[model samples]
Target: MTAPSAAHKPVRKSRAVKTLGFRIAALLVISIVVVVGLATLAARLVFHKPVDPEAVAPVARQIHILITLAERDPQAAREAGADVRDEPARGRVDPKASRFLKDMLAYTGRATDATVIREPNSPVLVASVRLKEGNWLVLSALDFSPPNVWPGFVAWIVLIVAGSGAISVLAAIKVTRPLRIIEEAVESVGPNGELPHIREDVGGNEVRATARALNRLSVRLKAAIESRMRLVAAAGHDLRTPMTRMRLRAEFLPEEERGRWLSDLEELDQIADSAISLVREESVSGDAETVALAPLLESLVADIAAADLPVTLGRVEEVDVCVGPLALRRALTNLIVNAATHGGGASVTLDIIESQAVIRILDEGPGIPESLIDQIFEPFFRVDLARRKTIPGAGLGMLIAREIIERLAGTITIENRDPRGLRQTISFPIAGVADGLLSAQDVECT
Candidate 1:
């Protein structure tokens, strides 16, 4: 198979990259992760101190009262479950608990450092502080269990994450909305020669810049295409005057020479007329209307049959499509004439398949070569080398037909039929509610 044009090749490769929506979502997810990570880091910095004053306050107050009692009366302090010992307790001191106990002693105006330990197999916290009499007073209280902050911390974290995610999604939507509009506008451009412009003031700087660029490009492209069509039309019209003068001058020649020159002039005239017609077909700007496929095909076949052409209509279905009636008829006529002149005879069929209207034109002549099938759609491309002594043509029939079909958001393809001939299939999307439906009275041929 032949490679696609450079324009289409880029599009195929572009599919490998991430789409705008996915990219935006990824960016938002990463942003949320980073933001949440930073928030967690800040929380750790502010709350990670080993000694918390509020957590150790109640335990410290009780220890201070017991110490006061021991300093006043040692026997009464012992009866009150406070023990004055000469040596430190045989237990491992928790550094965090010890730091908290030191802060507690300082807050209670005691000028001594205390050793805090967790008794084995007990929830009691013990602390040893030196008394004024040079004895270590062992103070004990139920362990100060700080309130569990994990559940509340987790709840706050969840809330923050969810809120951030929602905001990120909104931000992504805000960023991508204009891009989506631009994409729709670009895709809406068709062979109909209409280029829609997008709003440049609706998005961010980059999006607005892109919209402006696209608008300028659309305007330039439309102007260029129109200029080309005008040049073709003018060129075709200018040739007619010369051809007429040549025909007039040929009348003065010898009879034999006159016939030969006129025949050649007539062929030239036909080519010029075909070129003009092709240009006009391409420039067709009719609004799309609901047309019945069955009646249109029947009318075309009738016209061909009136010309004594071997054209048959078969399997006509009542399918409706939104298209320019005049352009569609002209395009179909070109295909039918091509089939009859080159393929010898033509058979037209219409059917509704998978919500699409399929129009097939089959002919009983030698089919085109597989290698040159795509080339035939190019303007003025001819398969004369393969056909040998085929009828003369300006080679714009298939090109005009394809342009018309594509303008109607349809596709036309040619394939070789088994045994002999070519099968040209044209498929159009079925008219939806937006295109509107046609009543019986509105089903006339153009």
Candidate 2:
């Protein structure tokens, strides 16, 4: 095999870096916002008090005006609703006014009362204390101006979280959307299909690199497919001359000899046909459609039966698959024909398993040799080369089946029945329209 060109191999890259960049950028933005919000909350709870005890106290101390005015006249103190006590004091000062003055003087002993004349509205500060006059003296002291700034602070927090969430969502879509597009484009290339081209216009550098890689792979793949097709065509053309001569010579031989020679020529023709089909199956360019796999299997069985083959189809119904209908039908026919030719008959079953349509064909003849089981999938490989003379099979059937199945994004696995024969299982994906028709008894492949 020739080494792939530079265009085919392209430069290798790790997608994790681009993915990590998007994640880190989005996370950093979100983290900063979260930190600021938390810091703001912490500062509010730690540094900003709910209600300042100092500010409230000064406001309560404005009652000092009435106390001082009541000190002047005895009748005036009583009439003005100032404290009137049942006690005597020096001078004509009202007894209640003298007591009130004494209490105010005692209350101001530890705290200040200097601004009374300079600022009457000066807020007061009062502490819990025992008063000799039986009433508490509450001093009010106030700052000329105090700041009230909390509502605006709270609004800032709400905005941060909402903004962070919105940014993260947009970032995730920016990253995931392009990746999904790449995925769909990759899926477009089946085992037989050509790879797609990478368009630089679709995304940034990372996406451009990916598209370039896909385009490179496409070129290499096209070359490989063309090579295989050429080989198949060459082989078919080369064998036709010998096959024609053998058929012509067989006409002049004894009846029994002619039968044997004719059968040999027929087998050669089958082999050539199988080679052509196998090459075609491998060089696909993703032309597939939804198909009802069960009905396809049933039809193959019916055809085999019409040809007088002893084939029994069990429960072939309602299993849909997405694939090339003609290619899948050919693959199934190859498998069924293989079983009929080698095992004399086949028991076929079709059903859905784990979102896949699975078709199984079992033969009651001696099972495949354990040693050759793996090699059986290789083109033109047979368990016993001598059996080719008697079996009338080209041995390319299973190989063709596998190639087609894989091209459809399915799989084919083989095993042996305990003491009897070979069991082959073909599984294909059910999706899109194929899945939608799952409820239908008979799905028509479009």
Candidate 3:
């Protein structure tokens, strides 16, 4: 494939990545996670109170006195509020609290063996110490159940956050459901170029409002388009009757006068035909078929050259594009003829660019004024009166060319070439070989 000309540039596809529903879903999920995490941290900080050393001082002194008495006399230790036990206490204990008790004993210069435990279904701490008589003395200590309660809360917090994530995903999906519906509805638009009626009475307020607006807009647009097409068609048919009668009358006039009258009538007829064709092209389209583009361009160039126009075929690469054969051929013919007849000469080249089949028609005549460039596609928008006088056209060629190209999901862009002349580039998404693209040998230049 030949390289794209400087005038031809590919633009980024913004719509492909910036989907409304996907963005909304991501925003919702991220918000929910942040909120859940922050809430959990706040709850943890609010309920987890710090220990007061003054309140624990009395309890620490009493336990120390009992442990000392139990080491000297076991009987006196029981009377001093200690629960005498022959064997080690049953059930598991908090090793952290036991170590704390040992540290307290060592601080008072009396190293003693100790174990602290909080049994299941119990709300109190039990501290046991080994006496000198080789028996055990157990005493009730202040509650140490906060440690146990907070650990289970950690698990609950985890479970809550996990469940919340799943719930958030579902909620996000629900939140963006209307957008998905709208997308599908647009994609499923009928061949009549009208949006299908959607439910406006159901769903959330926003969804219902959107649906109602779309339905109303579709109705108004379809009506407007149909009215315009009908008006153009009627006008085109009505003019032919008068023009035909005028042609008969002109036949009886002098040779010189008759030629002038006939030429004017023919031009008027051409204008009417162009207008009707534009209207029909706007309202309707046929099934698209994959056809080779190189052969098509070559054929168009050959036919126009044979007709004594300054048209030439340049380097063309084999590529297939999906489009209606006859409509595309007509549009191409109009564009090539415009370039050749107005731009002095036409050189057509077909190339493949980033999976798109690109056709560029280069001409060498004086290019359009920069300020008037945008209006070139307007119906009957001829350039200057001088160009109009020389060119035999209804000035609907470029307008019709753009309409037919866009209808087939292709693009047409025009820019003035450096120094002089205009270049028109047409591109359509490449349709890889499906049904065969007709080889040049099989297509006769018509």
Q: Per-candidate TM vs. native?
A: 0.64, 0.52, 0.63
Query: In model 3, what lDDT does residue 13 have?
Result: 32
Cα lDDT of model 3 by residue, 51-82, tens digit: 55455656777777776787778778777667
lDDT of 3 at 153: 60
In model 1, the runs with Cα more than 4 Å from the true position are: 1-19, 38-157, 197-211, 248-264, 287-291, 306-308, 320-325, 364-366, 369-371, 386-389, 407-410, 416-421, 429-446
How are the candidates ranked when ordered by lDDT, highest leading?
Answer: 3, 1, 2
lDDT of each: 0.75, 0.64, 0.76
Worst lDDT window (10 residues) for model 2? 436-445
Assess the local accuracy of residue 361 in candidate 3 as a C-alpha lDDT between 0 and 100.
97
Model 1, 1-446: lDDT tens digits are: 12122122111123212366567766777677677767876877788665566776776777787778888898999887788888767698877767767777788667576788888898788878877777788867445445457787778667766877778777767777666655555555556454566677776787788878878988998899888888888988899999999999999999989988997887677778877877776675456677888988888899999999899998888989877788899889999989988899999999988978999999999889999888978877777755423466677778888877776667899999999999999998887832322211112112
What would the per-residue lDDT of candidate 2 be over residues 1-446, giving only the tens digit for each residue? 12123223323244754576578567857786879978987886699654434444433344444444444553685576554443321122223323333344445432322222112343332122222443332332233332445677668866876777677766665666556545545545545556545565767666677777767877988798788789887898789998898888889999979987888789889989878767666654234666777667777898999998889988766866667778778888888888887887899998877777788899988888888789888878887788977766777888888887775667899988888998998887675634332211112234
Residue 261, model 2: lDDT of 82
User: By descending TM-score, how would the candidates be arranged?
Assistant: 1, 3, 2
lDDT of model number 3:
0.76
Off by over 4 Å in 3: 1-23, 26-54, 60-158, 187-192, 196-220, 242-266, 284-292, 319-323, 353-355, 369-374, 429-446
